[model samples]
Target chain A: MSAQPVPLVPVLAVVGIGLIGGSFAAALRRAGQVGRVLGVGRRQASLDRALALGLIDEVVDLEQAARRADLILLATPVGAMRAALEALGPHLRPEALVTDAGSTKADVAAIARAALGERLRQFLPGHPIAGSEMTGPEAAHPALYHGRKVVLTPLAETPVRARDWLTRVWEACGAHVLLMDAERHDRVLASISHLPHLLAAAYMAQVSREGDADLRLSLAGTGFRDFTRIAAGSAEVWRDIFLSNRESVLDELAAFERVLGELRKTLEDPDPRALEAFLEQAALARRLWDGRSAMT
Target chain B: MSAQPVPLVPVLAVVGIGLIGGSFAAALRRAGQVGRVLGVGRRQASLDRALALGLIDEVVDLEQAARRADLILLATPVGAMRAALEALGPHLRPEALVTDAGSTKADVAAIARAALGERLRQFLPGHPIAGSEMTGPEAAHPALYHGRKVVLTPLAETPVRARDWLTRVWEACGAHVLLMDAERHDRVLASISHLPHLLAAAYMAQVSREGDADLRLSLAGTGFRDFTRIAAGSAEVWRDIFLSNRESVLDELAAFERVLGELRKTLEDPDPRALEAFLEQAALARRLWDGRSAMT
Candidate 1:
């Protein structure tokens, strides 16, 4: 790609220099859209690794990040966002617009309101729906967000200029940015993302608990591997996500149970036609979704 | 792979020219283990496709296949197994070994017992745990079973000589062969393969029925794709599988419900630690399985 005549953002500070944060900086660097990246994190060794890995130019504290950054992105676990926002609130520059890469939006929006007070208007809650099983600076790659969806949940007081600018920046990272309200974003994520994760993990654990667990695992083929892939996601991150969006997740689980009940009825009925119809509904929809996804 | 000095089987008849049958033929051809592959199918077009794809040498009927072949493999969907066996029963040679690649073993074994009569001694109930979402001869590959698992659930009257020969044939296809009782094999498969497919299909159908389904599907990323991959399996095959092993599958579903109940309790309690602990169990078990699989 041709380098831009001028960087889009003079300085970008990334909090929690893990896969999301490090990859954001790398994507921006590849696009030649950011002049410098300042990494902030809880651990010093991780920052050093980020520097060694060329994921950052320098390491800085939250106070320095707030004072110097043209834009600041919080890529921490949602549980850590409130503290990061509180630390940044006191020193955050007037021109700086803040955003996050947290999975849950409503909780992060609430945290920003509570922590940043008046500066909360500058915060746009965003989540990049990308592979997240791998974490840390070592797992970061420039193309992590390429052709992925980045959902931005902007508040009422959020500036149009900042929203449009953030959208352009994510577009430079090869992400398609979509706008949604925080509550709706959280609910949508609970249905499509969080509930699936919980189900995979739960199924994996359940199968592992069986008396013939070893034989079952040994016999598991591609289907089991694919279905339980999300079960390998980081425990801490998922815990925070489940707890942060408990109500939505619980609601999705109930929905899943209802579907299972219907499936069980078909099985118990020994109704071959009904069973085939149920499975065919899923097969048809899955094929249609694949076709739809291929276009976009 | 190097060709065997002599063809392992002089004449091999495959009673279904779909993915499983075609792949088995292709795999044996690659290993130089079969002299001629006689294909039998209900559809002439599919049989022609199998021939054109080089998955079979020629098309033949069940009587000709039984009369002329040294070995026969019934790779048709489980629901069609009894009819196929019945067709072969009258013309079958006593020395000719018969094996099946059906997903459900207990039902197949029972069907064989009734149809094959005294010739049940020669039948081996087998399942090649390979990628199965893709069907038809075009989806078959010579290396489809490479580094995969093949489980054989032999009946009490099954001859050891035939069992040994089938094991070697599958090994030539680069699969690790394991033996289990038919009932246990069904239960193990129910827990691992069948249950995952059912859950994936059910989840995909449920998501498609949602009011915000378009939005939800648009936002779905790699996780959704992998989690629902198995829902794309042939509906008739999966329906037959679920019906054939209904009791085992229903038992697994009950087990799954118990696990989901525990998960729901933790979420409702808003117990972060308990939630984290639960997820960690699955993550740890899944990781261990991956490691074990890598080694084996």
Candidate 2:
């Protein structure tokens, strides 16, 4: 980074312009850092929404955007990143720096390296710790990444030039970037992010069955609302993460099951002291975290 | 009953004036529904705060307040409800319509019936669908019950005159009242409210112990934040509820574990059709309920 800010880039290409991608384009445009923003997506409606919402200056073909762009941002779902890379791999300009907003890093980085080898050194795999239950172009918000942490998982072979440029881009997009290894990134997300989703879905499904089964859901307050709210999110998106990050998620899930089993035993024995201790520790840990800042 | 809006009751006693009771006192005073709101609590600090915050006009002895007041609202923890009722049982005036904010209803109503039979006709065991993670007198808010449901688990033997008077009181507090049998009330809450808490706490306990847990927690965004938020709430309050309403809560927990076990098996295999069906069913049920409004 320079002591003085660099001049605004002229053009930027956002591949797979969904919620994250669309929001990136909108935020950059709103910041007036990019003279022209181009969005690339398979769906015409998504491209239209991106253009209409002023998220981008134009809808450009993937290859055209890749060739003309000063930077390329991958904002597709994690499962789609590999296929997206295959399409953009050959056309990616040598001068252009590539980065992604996929949640998982190991698979994306590995796929990029396998597809483009030395050229992949230019690609930076990053996950922004910001999102909502809502998805796609309509849900995009400019302030989504403001004051939020963005994690970049870079390989040992990753180019210093690319990393610097990528950091600058994220900072311009109003994110505080942290860099870590791909395996570590995957492990962390599996425990905190992926496991929560699985737990919510499984738990919610228990109450969701049809019957004269007693449910005072009408009387559920904000606590219950907030807790189970994510259970209603996109299942396909969660399924993709769970399947792709299976090993890490499974490891975390097993850890969780063990804790739950212990809790179950404690409950059975009516150990008030043990139960209270468990709850107090959790409350303390949660209280130490900043309440206003959204935990991603 | 008066032909006009029943003349505002002058003397109101808030029994067990902790979080909800203090807030109720404040709301009543703010709305000018009561001239002298008496607060009864076992704690001195809470009584002091209630007086300082102007939640009550006076801090009085429970029996003394019961003798003087036209209305009594119980806001104690579920476990303390029976003890509170037993202490105040003989002193409750025939004209004073009693209600509560306890989570569980069956036991409270049963205890009221057994201990204060004729006066039990005056007791309307109610559960207000309002709360925050924060507790005690300080966390009290006037708007907590706004747009939320207040379930009146009126027993079969509850007198029509008393039930009507109790309904008027709940209405004055800005709650939408719904009548249901006590048993059904417990069952419903077990599924919608209690089950979700168990799931969230169990999941939080499970995932937070793994390697790289801190890193994963750092990456957990809004999704994880909302999901685990209730896990940070008062452990004493929840633990008491679980123990007090053990039968219903345990039954719900068993149901949840069974469902989760099924999901675990499904995850072990990649049966797309079955998983999609499971997700679709859950999504449909969620959509059927009003987003956040249904929660209260």
Best by DockQ, which number? Answer: 1
Candidate 1 residues lying further than 4 Å off, grouped into runs, are: A1-6, B1-6
The complex in candidate 2 yields a DockQ of 0.58
Model 2 misplaced stretches (Cα beyond 4 Å): A1-10, A29-35, A134-142, A213-215, A291-296, B1-10, B26-35, B110-122, B134-143, B291-296
Worst 10 residues of 1 chain B by lDDT: B1-10
Cα lDDT of all candidates, in order?
Answer: 0.90, 0.76
DockQ of each: 0.84, 0.58
- Per lDDT, the best of the predicted structures is 1
Superposition error at B186 for model 2 (Å): 1.8
What is the clash count of model 1? 0
Model 2 pairs in collision: A188-B216, A220-B295, A256-B206, A295-B220, A295-B221, A296-B219, A296-B220, A296-B221
Please give, for residues B207-296, the per-residue lDDT of candidate 2 as tens digits: 555555566566667787788887777789778777667688777778877887777665677666666666666665555554545454
lDDT of each residue in B190-221, candidate 1, tens digit only: 99989998899889888988999999999998
lDDT of 2 by residue, A1-296 (tens): 33544435668899887778888877776675777788888899988987888888788887787788888888888776677777777887778777888878888888888867778776888988888767788898888788888899877877887787777777878988999998888888887788777777776677767264334556666776677667676777666776777788777778887877776665777888887777766665565443534343
